[model samples]
Target: MEKKVTLPKHKFHIQAGDTVVVIGGNSKGLRGVVKEVIVEKDRARVEGVAMITKHMKPTASNPQGSLVKTEGSVHISNLMVIDPATGEPTRTGRKVNEKGKLQRFSKKTGNFIPDAYRKQ
Candidate 1:
């Protein structure tokens, strides 16, 4: 029998509820909150970017068949995390804080993001 080994999922600096800006694609320059992050696929679903329309038949939820609008997953490479301190898009880095806790910080301005801004 052959044994299969699974690789660990990729880690991302972006997290849910983080404010992000689309740097490329049709939604370029648009800002939205991170609804979900797919670490394995390196994609994220933003609140208002990459809108797509889907046609669905009538179901229990929808009495009538209609077009539903939704946001599609955006590639991580095309998205940039917005720095709360600078109000600009910047790369993120992880560091150990003075209390010996892992914290996310902006590489651009070297500002550490407070816990209040991150989603628990």
Candidate 2:
């Protein structure tokens, strides 16, 4: 017999399409747009960073296998979102705006950061 429990999903500071800079690992100092975030693994795929070689097996479309170079996921902990106001990497915070909707903000500048998927 075992007891099962469920935990709430973690709220990550970084999101897709945000401009981020790699602070750690071999890709340190590299900057790119975040392509996707893996909530389960707590990793993110950044454009043009963490290049990896993948060997794809031959498929019906092609007879020969192919070696594909693609971007690999980097841990979210290694990424810092760039501030839209100051154009520099900075820590982020979440707070309710005047509209009563929660949003992210840059700690360095105290400026509100707009959501990447949302348009005003």
Local accuracy by lDDT, each model: 0.88, 0.95
User: What are the per-residue Cα lDDT tens digits for candidate 2 across 52-112?
Assistant: 9999999989789899999999999999999988889999999999999999999999999
Q: Ten-residue segment with the worst summed lDDT in candidate 1? A: 111-120
Q: Which regions of candidate 2 are displaced past 4 Å? A: 1-5
Estimate, for each residue in 16-95, the C-alpha lDDT of model 1 and write its tens digit. 88888999999999999999888878999999899999999998998888998999999999988899988999998889
**Model 2, clash count?**
0
Residue 59 miss distance in model 1 (angstroms)? 3.5
Query: What does candidate 1 score in Cα RMSD to the true structure?
Result: 2.4
lDDT of 2 at 26: 96
Clashes by residue pair, model 2:
none
Name the lDDT value of residue 4 in candidate 2: 84
